[model samples]
Target: MMNYKIFIWMLIVPFVINGQNKISGNHSTQNLTCSTCHSCDIPTKENPCIKVCPRESMIRIDQPVTDAPKIFVINKIRETDIYSPVKFSHLAHAEMSGLAGGCRTCHHYNPPGNVIGCSDCHESSRKRTDISKPDLKGAYHQQCMNCHRAWSGSTDCTVCHELKGKEKSQTSVVSNNKKRIHPEIKTPDKISFAAKTKQGKLVTFYHNEHINLFSLECSDCHSNESCIKCHSTNKTASTKTISEKIKHKKCSSCHNTESNCSSCHSNSEAGGFNHKSVTGFDLSKFHSKLDCARCHTSKSGFKGLNNECKTCHGTWTLENFKHKSTGLVLDETHSELDCENCHKELSYSKPVCEDCHDDKSYPNNLPGKRAK
Candidate 1:
């Protein structure tokens, strides 16, 4: 009787395995053998050996929020539930993160691959054995509370979610999202810092121009900032006697804050950054939209680059140069002529036609017919 039963069981097991394989989905189609996350040969309800949290070296990679889902349905927490799934504003958080820490604010330990959700490392069950880290419920609240408390000064549960089925979670989500998110953070045009220094008392920071003209991201200048830094009601701050190096640490990365005291430090509130006035290079038309780092490649010291276009753009010759692209299509005769013939200085600034046509000059005379 035992021998006959064993033979029947062995025959039935193969068909069951075939049936499991028949189902096709992300989980079933995964290359992962059962052993990848489960140690048991045949995992079952009786004694399934499931892996712990963060089963392997977790992969994290930066992805634009545009690629990420705009809203995340966080309904993973199961047990005694008080509220419906929170309709998270994934895109709003991601867009706001650009000025803060980018996607790394929450996905800190993500390995370099697909972007994983918070539940990847944080187990959904709070009763699980992994006590080292917060469970999914705790992780979600923690991340949410950071900004929510800052935004409204309240951690009330209703602020983000609804009581199970009392209100339509979808309607509330749409209403909250449509109402207003973080108001447009107005960058200060000028920030007058009162410096306790003999060289100067006031240092005027050209806040908007740095963002508009220099093309600097808010994070580049204000990295590692917290909500308390801006939203704190207390206007007064504790005094700390910091060194000159410490005082200049943030600005030093882009400006020479050490010896060039006169440049920034003034008895009066100093003027904003002026390209032509300070560096003798007017960036009004050509380089107005460019970041400081574009031309000033050196991160340590923003040393000056040569005024010649060839300094950055390799040597330009008649064959490679496109005269028509300069808003002026060169005439047949001028097209064959060397650039230096008309552009005597060839500084790549306004060309001086007086070299050949002594009477003709740029803007007044046509190098070629006006590019229609």
Candidate 2:
């Protein structure tokens, strides 16, 4: 049946991809198409025919924890009322999930529109005939137990829920309930890795540059990380047995791993990413904070830019290019003067005044008036 669904989907792939000018709700920018989450060819507004398996649904979006509700009353299963509804601390759980997994920790199978709660998939009643998937009560307790049992080492139901009519136990002292987001992870400036390469043994990964400098979010790199990576006490990492090609899989997303062995690995420890060293363009002054995609502009990968102002901004004859954006607005005299008078180089990295005034050099001479 799955193969039949895929076969039918292939026929309408072109139309849904190009012909249909449709925008999915709350996920327009996501470019959510039929194939993104649906297995059926022509998914309608009434029925999307969403794939049950979350792994099969390729649209996994991890949203900020603050965006989620602070507290959710997991009282969907009211039939079995031996216990009161679980007052789930959503934000607290979200913050705790940060160390292990993001939203996927709970919302494992999110479609394009919104995250599907456990009640959506799991049946509310435990006495249901379908034993394939655990009922809602089973699903809820299982998810809660994974972490609660890990910490407490007991399956005590009171850890998450309180008995009926126990008003005092229903509400626990939660700290700053509204402000429930994961604390910003302190990124390391450099992380040295011992690579099993012939030439370069050490590779330094720049954790800080990727976040603050490159403007990469935590989710961009840590998409499907497991909780065991950090919290597991006895779980041994399986990286030792992995092949050389597989070793570079993590970095292959943005970097060229096959040919650039020496770029990352070396006899000594590798240094952090430097624009001057790699692209011959020093990003220290101006371009340090800009994302790599800003200048690269290519959706495929980051290639070197020409470094000339005209390369991106065409014919900057003084009126177009705003000097004020550079933190120092040019004065009338400096602005009026042709750029060639001061800047003689092909690139604007450094400007020289040798042509205009032999005695006056840049930084010493006031070619342009500093804007107040």
Candidate 3:
């Protein structure tokens, strides 16, 4: 009887090994390498050596808040609870997410196509076998509580959920939430920072000028910021305790913070950025409407550029050039001449008419009527 039992156990071991191999083969059909899910090259069924979710490598789709549903009724989790479903204002949170990390703040593992919900990745039931990640209810509370706690300094259940019996009509709640949107963030025109520097103390930053004139987006600087940065319940949260490097990190991206200290820092509050005063290139005449990127093409921030027409407008000729747009329309005779005939210099400054007529000169003897 003992010999027969040993032979039977040997046969069952091979079948169990084949079943494990078959399970692994099914995973291979999905075109995933061992490293995709496992940390080790050879993972066993008992110890798969599964890697934790790599959020940084995950592909995320960022859509406008207008594309998302305005409201979401969270009812799947609290079916048997005393509270009714929470009417979550999706649009309101998405709009505020612009300052933060966008959709990745909540949807950490979002891939291409439709935005997935927390329940898709996290198991809805608490009795789930995989205990590595949080359950659906835990995920919902974790994501919401972090920001809500900072903003209000409280994580009360009633803050989001409405008690089943004491709640208002569901129709009214859904209708009110649909129209919900984040309040417009007021932008400052300028901010004067008191810096501790030997060169200067006051650093006057033209805030609106960077947005309107420089064409910088909010995310360029505020991408890594948390909800506490803006929505903190404590109004007395001072930035004075922040390190010097942290304070200059944002400006260092565009400006030479290491060497050019006096450019920003000054003994007194400095005026707005002056192109002519700083770079000797007056943009008010021709390049006022142009974007900063139109001229500053280098990835290492704006560098000194040659102030010559040929540097940018290399293709400009008598036939293609529009003189009327320059506020001076040339006459039939002058129009026929090449650009170098009057404007001898590459700078394209005031025209010298002495090359043709000895007595005649620009501003006195008009080539053509000044364009209206």
Candidate 4:
């Protein structure tokens, strides 16, 4: 009986082996073998499977990495030493980008993939992949300011950087609850914002007074968007020098030469002050050859017939009604000279007889004589 049983067990085990092998043979080579059949689709500790998955199913299984850090560099000078560090702000800026969609909106990557580490191209020292490596400071300012400029709103220096001597966090918005602790005190009404011009002229502009009296929309002088709309990035600006960037176009639109003058000259008592409460001057002939400020003096408030001739052609008496014919007085032969000759410096000043009269003597030939 034992011999019969062993023989039967040998035959049965062979049959089981053949059955398992048959099952394995029927499936694709990339899929399960007999021993692995049941565990086929599952990923495991020892043997992971990429085995015969659909594209979408692969994505579901592999799910690409998110929350990767976008990194760059910035160079800041501390105690006369410059540090170029690999600054990574994955958390804070990711929230902003998620709302804006994705990384390509602000950052550019080469040989693209879902990767975010800056080391793909930039070095640990914050150096670029190629010979044209941008320094860390240049990289940051270019990226940040370009995005900032593309966004629709006012762009001023204060928007990103603090004014020369202020803290970055100092300019942040304060909540009402936080304000209640100390309760910011209102500034006293008498406090003024007057300042002296580069030319040593005092200019006083009243902020509260204009708000209280004129009922002026803040946009009246400023653009519809805000104060910087006209003065800053949106407009085409040119200056005598970089320091003089506040071109008068910003102010002249609201208070042209006429209105700026009316601020004071409208109330002054001076003859031929036939100052039209005009919009601006329509310069013609000789007047066109004069400097804008020649008649628009700080003392003159920028208007009036400041045409006392002496205002421009100083001290030479117009043989009373002398220029009435040419409508400009040629008191001395100096007055008879070409308009551009004396005003050649291209700044507004009196057309002096001595400007061209090399032989002319001062206080005799011309009063208030200026050497050419």
Best model number under TM-score: 3
- Please count the clashing residue pairs in each candidate, in the order shown: 5, 2, 0, 1
How well is each residue in 92-111 modelled by candidate 4, as lDDT tens digits? 45434432423443344422
TM-score of 2: 0.67
Expressed as tens digits, the lDDT of each residue in 1-372 for candidate 1 is 999999999999998687645534544544566666666677665555655534334434556678977778778888536777778788778766766666777776664557778887788988988577789889988887886687567778887777866867466677778554667887778888888777688888888887887677788877666565667534453244667777799888777776888787899876777788987878886777777778788766568889877777776778988877667898898888877767756366677777678687778888677776
Q: Which stretches of candidate 1 lie over 4 Å from their true place?
A: 1-60, 233-247, 280-301, 307-372
Provide the lDDT at 54 for model 4. 27
Listed in order, each prediction's TM-score against the native is 0.64, 0.67, 0.83, 0.22
Instruction: Write candidate 2's Cα lDDT for 209-259 as tens digits.
Output: 777766676766676655545545444552337676766886898888878
Give residue 274's error in model 2 in angstroms: 2.3
User: How many clashes (backbone atoms < 3 Å, residues ≥3 apart in a chain or on different chains) does model 4 have?
Assistant: 1
**lDDT, residue 351, candidate 3:** 91
TM-score of 3: 0.83
Looking at model 2, residue 317 earns an lDDT score of: 68
List ranges where model 2 is wrong by over 4 Å. 1-55, 58-68, 78-84, 95-101, 147-158, 162-168, 173-184, 235-246, 285-294, 318-345, 348-372
Model 1: lDDT to the true structure: 0.73
Model 1, residue pairs in steric clash: 59-110, 59-111, 60-110, 60-111, 60-112
